[model samples]
Target: MKVPETALPDERPNTGARPVDYDAELRLHNRAFRHACAILARERVLDIGCGAGQTTRDAARAASAGSAMGIDTSSSMIARARELAAAEDVRNVRFELGDAQTHSFPPQGFDVAISRFGTMFFADPIAAFRNIRGALADDGRLIMMVWQALEANEWSLAIQGDRPQSSAAFSLADPSLAKKILDAAGFADATFQDVHEPVYYGDSVEAALAWIGQFQATREALRSLDAAAVERERTRLREAVAQHHRDDGVWFDSRAWIISARCR
Candidate 1:
């Protein structure tokens, strides 16, 4: 279904920018995502919608025989990726900043393209997938991870308290819709597997609340609300999180779908 444009990251001032904790997220989920990279053991890789280049570097390691390139629409994210790549002294990886729908790659640019929670924001799924297919080699594969459904994910549901009215915020929860769009884009062998995981927060409930306030879009949208509503939402979140805290810290059960397909 078509949705109206609203609250895009670029519209906000460094609001949607990737946070430092995103690296921690990658480190935590890398083991879970390794299977997505396994199929590309000896093939070149492309990471579309790459955020800070973590998975790109991982794919590079997985495909030691071929190079890896990461592309993202956000210039700041691409800049951070380049810096991280240099600091880590990682070779065989490159990054560029441009919209995936319009960006051009060299002929037979990649043998495999991958994304982790990165391909879902596209305004035009078919056009974006077509661009991705154009960038891949004949036998190339594509793998990605996306939220399974809104109700199945607590991480997203927990922070829904303060979210404002926006088309973009509520649009990414449909797996069947996404599968249909991908099929229409000429992708074949489309498959989705459900994976349940836990997303952790800090040792204190307050800290967890603060992290969500800073990073969660729904919370940010609430911040745009009057002070009373914001405080009420904050209180609600704290109470919700208190029930989930343990000796280790605050944690929430989350669910996602690992989507894989081939360019056809």
Candidate 2:
């Protein structure tokens, strides 16, 4: 199951270089994996949107006799995943770059499917889950994490302000809606468990401001406002970060749903 080396750009999507948000978000996702690993059957596992393959490698280790496959749309992520797997000498894991919505996964090949805050961005969630169902063995488990409502997640609220509609992270925020979509996608017993955690943004206000400013959309949204208004917004954000500052770093509350279902 050893995979070959792949080249990546200077930065990857799920890496710390991309955004500090990803760092905290990744913690949430990986934390969910610890709970989801209970379903591993040591047959075969597939990690959808497996950014850097840490969870994929973990699954591979859990399924020592089997194999793990990590697939993501970003080639950089896939490449970095391969590098991590190689650096760890992980032979039972592989990474591929492909879109989960239409990727040609093997028929009934996986015993369990896992994702970490990765399945929410699909243009057609039902179609994507249906395709994922096709990749699983009969009655295989689908364990993944999606965000709760925008208002529930403090970090999202702080950064998003009045513009929470831009990101697809909250698409599955509603439990009933998520269950309905999964049911339509040929999955059964969709469940959402509330997971409250704190997301680390930065060690200082300057650091947090720098990281938060990386969000170009926020800048774009504020472009129409006069300089004073923009400064006021910036000051608002800085004060918000300062309120959450701690000895270790800046942390904010976040809420997520640990969704689990079975392929029907």
Q: Candidate 1's residue-wise lDDT over 120-237, tens digit each?
A: 7788878888888888887778788776666676777776744532344324457677667777776788777776777776555655655565554754576476777766765677
lDDT of each: 0.71, 0.78
In terms of lDDT, the poorest run of 10 residues in model 1 is: 2-11
Model 1 alpha-carbon drift over 4 Å, by segment:
1-20, 26-28, 39-41, 162-175
The most accurate candidate by lDDT is: 2
For model 1 the local lDDT of residue 55 reads: 88
